[model samples]
Target: MRIVVPAGGIGGARFLRGLKAALGIGADLTEDDPTITVIGNTGDDITLFGLRICPDLDTVMYTLGGGINESQGWGRAEESFAVKEELAAYGMQPTWFGLGDRDVATHIVRTQMMAAGYPLSAVTEALCDRWRPGVRLLPMTDDRVETHVVVADGDGGRRAIHFQEWWIRHRAALPALEIVSVGAEDAKPAPGVVEAIDEADLVLLPPSNPVVSIGSILGVPGVRAALERATVVGVSPIIGGAPVRGMADACLTAIGVETSAEAVAAHFGPDLLDGWLVDTADAGASVEGVTVRARPLYMSDPDATAAIARAALDLALELKGDRP
Candidate 1:
C-alpha cells in the first residue's frame, strides 16, 4: 500500500521505524517493497553558526537509517562533541545548543548545497541517497517557516523566541502565551508533498506534538485539504491525561486544548481525521463523529511499536472500507 506519514522528530521517527517493521521489511529495503512517503516537519528548522539545521528531518533520517543514538532518540550514534568544545573555547555564543562533530557535517553539506541554489527538497533527496532511509522523505515546505513561541520576558513583558531555543534552552518551562508559525502564510507545500497525500491509500499521524509538529505541516497551504480527502488516522501523543513524552501539555495549553486523547482527536476534528487511537489506559475516550479505539500506545520496543502501527493501519483500512 502507498502510505503517507506526516511526522515530527523523536516520536514520529520511532513510529516510522515500527511501521517499516510492521510491513515485514528488514534493514535494507528493496524494489517492490511498499511505498511510504514521510512528510517531515520543518518548522523547527533553524540557522545556527551560518549553517542550516533541520532537526526533525535529520532525526527521521538517522533513526530510519540505523544511525540513531538509541539512548537519546536523536543525534548520531557514537557521536562526539569535539567541534562544540572548540567553538565554546573560542567563546561562541549559545553553547546550550551543542552540535556534535558528526552532526555538523550534515549542516555544512546542506548549507553549501542551498548556497548553490538547490531547494531544500532537492538537498534532502541528495542527503537521503546516503542514509537510504527506505522511505521518500520530503520537507513540509522549501520556504523558510519557523515555529516561534511567545513567552514571558521575566521583566513583566513577553518576547518571541525560536521554538528550539524555547524547547532546548528553557525546556518549555515558561508558559507559552502564543505559538506562531512564521512565514507559513506564504509558504507552499514542498515538492511531492501534495501528491504523496493525494495518492496515498492511507495517511498516518504519529504520536508527535500536535501544536508544532503535525500542526505546522497542516499549516502549509494545501496539506490539510489533501489530507482531508485521504483516509487519515492519528495515534494520540497524550496518554492518561498526560503526554507520553515531551511537554506537549504546555503546547496544548498554549492553543487552549486540553491534554487528553479525546481533546486532541476533537482538535483535529472529524473533518480531517477518520480514526483515532488512544492507549488502553484511556479506553473510554471518545470524539464526536470520529472512530476511536483503545490500544497500547507506548512503543517499548520494535515488536510493540509495530503492533501499534499495525493497529493504526487496520483502523485506516476499516475507515476506508466504511466510506462510499
Candidate 2:
C-alpha cells in the first residue's frame, strides 16, 4: 500500500503526521516499512548567510522526526535565536526571517554537503539519516527551482522577490502580480519522484499552499504527466471561502482562482486529480469530472487529522474502482 504525497511546509507536515497515525506508524518508527513517500517542495529553498535553508523540507523532516516546534508549526522545539540576534546586532540585511540556533545547525550541515558537490536530494537524504522521519522523503527536484513573487514596489514599479521575502517579510501583504517558478521550465523531477508516483497505489495532496507548495512540485517536468496516470486525491486547503491555514487565499488570487474548495479542485482539474475532499461546509461543492466527498477537514489534533487522512484514502480507493 504505497502512497505518494506532494507536500509543502507546515500544513503538509502536519497532515503527514496524521497520515502516519492512520497507518498505525509511530513517530519513532525507524524501520524501512515506509508505505509513504513524500515529495517535498523545494521552491522555498533559499540561500541565507551563505547557508542553504530549506524551510519546507526541514519543516517536514522536523515535524515527522518529533523535533518540530508544536506551537509555531515551524522551526525546532525549545529553540534559541542567539545566532539570529547576533547577526542582527551586526546589522545584517533581511533580518525579518527567524532562524533559531538549533535550526541553523541543519542549515550548516545542508550547506556543507551542498558545497561538497552534493545535490539537494542527496543532502536531504543525508540530513534525514539522523532524523529518520518515518516516510521516505524526497525533494521535488534536484535543480534550483525557486518561487519568486512579482509585487508592485512603493515607487509604482514591479520587482520579483523570493517567496520567503514576500511570505516572511511582508506576510504576503503586497499583492502578488505573478508567482513564478524561476527554474521550473528546465527542472527535472528528483531521482525517485516520478518512480514513486508511478508505482504508488494512491497519491495524496495535502492541504498546503497550492501556488508555491504543491503547485511548485507539479511544475517540475514529468510530475504532472506522471500524476495523470495515478489515482490522486486532494484535500482542499480552502473551506467556506477561506483558507484553513496559512495565506493560501492570496496565492490563489494571484493565479486568478477564487478562494474556494470548488475553485481549487477545478484548478487542479480532472486531468490530474481523480477525487477531491472538501470540508463538510463545502459539501455542496462539485467539480466537472472529479468525485467529491465532504468531511471534517480541520486537523485539530492527531485523531482528527487521522480521520481526515482515512477519509481521503477511502475516497481514493473508491475512485480507483470507478476508473475502468
Candidate 3:
C-alpha cells in the first residue's frame, strides 16, 4: 500500500509518528508494510543569519527519526542554545527566535548545500538520509515560496511580514489583512510530489494548520489538482471550537474561515476530501458529499495518535469501497 500525506510542523510530525506506528513499521513485523510519502510544507522556510531553516521539514524529520524534543515537540532533543545566547550577547538583532546548538548544524548544512546550487528538494533528501525518517519526505516546492502576512503597520498603513515574524515575534496578535503565499502561483511541486499523489492508494491530511500548512501545499500549482484524483481523508485540527494545538484559530480567522470542524471540512470541500475525521466532541458535525466520522482526536501519545490514524485509514478504505 502507498499513502501520501501533506503535512506541516508539530501536529503533522506527531501524527506521522503515530501513522508509522499504526502501519507496524516500528514494530517487529514484516507484513502490511506501506510506503509512506510526506509532502512537507516549505512555506515556513526562512533565512536567519544567512542560513536556510526549513522548520516543517526538520520537525517531521526529527519527530519521525526519534530525535525531536518530546516536551516542546520541535527542535532537537537535549538541545543547548549557546549559539543563540552568544549571538544575543553580541547584540544581534531578531533574538526572539531561538536556534539551538544542535539545530544550527542542520541549518548550516542546508544553507551550504543551497549555496552550492542544489535545489531545496535535494538538500532535504540529503538531510533525511541521516535521519532515515522511514517515509519519503519531499518539500512541497523547490522554489522559494514563503507565507507572508499583510498586517496593520500602526501608522494607518499595511506592511507584509514573514509568517515567522508575525507568528513568533508578534504571536499573531496583530490583525492580518491578508495571508499570501509569495511565489506560489509560479511554483511547481517538488520532484515526485505529483506522482506520489497520483499513485497513492490513500492521501491523508493530518491535523495541520489549514491556512498556512496544508493550504500552502495546495497553493502550489498542480498539487491540489493532483490531490483531487486520490481518495483523500483529513483529520480536523480543531477539536470542538479551538485548535488542538497552536494558534490555528488565528490563521483560520486570517483566512476568513470559522474555527469549527465542520467549517474546516467545508473549506476543503467534498470535491477534494472523501472522508473527514472530527473529534468525539463534534459527533454531530456533518458536511455535504463527505463522510464524517467522530473519534477521539487527541494525539496525546503515540498509542492515542496511532488509534486516530487507524481510524482515518479505515474510513478511507471504507470510502474507497463505496466509490463507483
Top TM-score prediction, candidate number: 1
lDDT of 2 by residue, 1-324 (tens): 899999999999999999998888875665655489999999999999998999999999999999999999999999999999999999987699899999999999999998999999999999999998889899999999999999998798999999999999999999999999999999999999999999999999999988899999999999999999999999999989999999999999999999999999999999989999999999999998899999999999989999999899999988888878
User: In candidate 2, which residue pairs get closer than 3 Å at backbone N, Cα or C atoms, i.e. clash?
Assistant: none
Q: Local error of candidate 1 at 20, Å?
A: 0.3
lDDT (tens digit, per residue) of candidate 3 on 1-324: 999999999999999999998887862334567989999999999999888999999999999988999999999999999999999999987898879999999999999999999999999999988888888899999999999999988899999999999999999888888999999999999999999999999999999999999999999999999999899999999999999999889999998999999999999999899999999999999999999999999999889999999999999989999877
lDDT order of candidates, top first: 1, 3, 2
TM-score of 2: 0.98
What TM-score quantifies how close candidate 3 is to the native fold?
0.98
TM-scores of the candidates are 0.98, 0.98, 0.98
Report the lDDT of model 1 for residue 57. Answer: 99
Q: Candidate 2 — what's its lDDT? A: 0.94
* Lowest lDDT 10-residue stretch of candidate 1: 24-33
lDDT of each: 0.95, 0.94, 0.94
Better of 1 and 2 by lDDT: 1
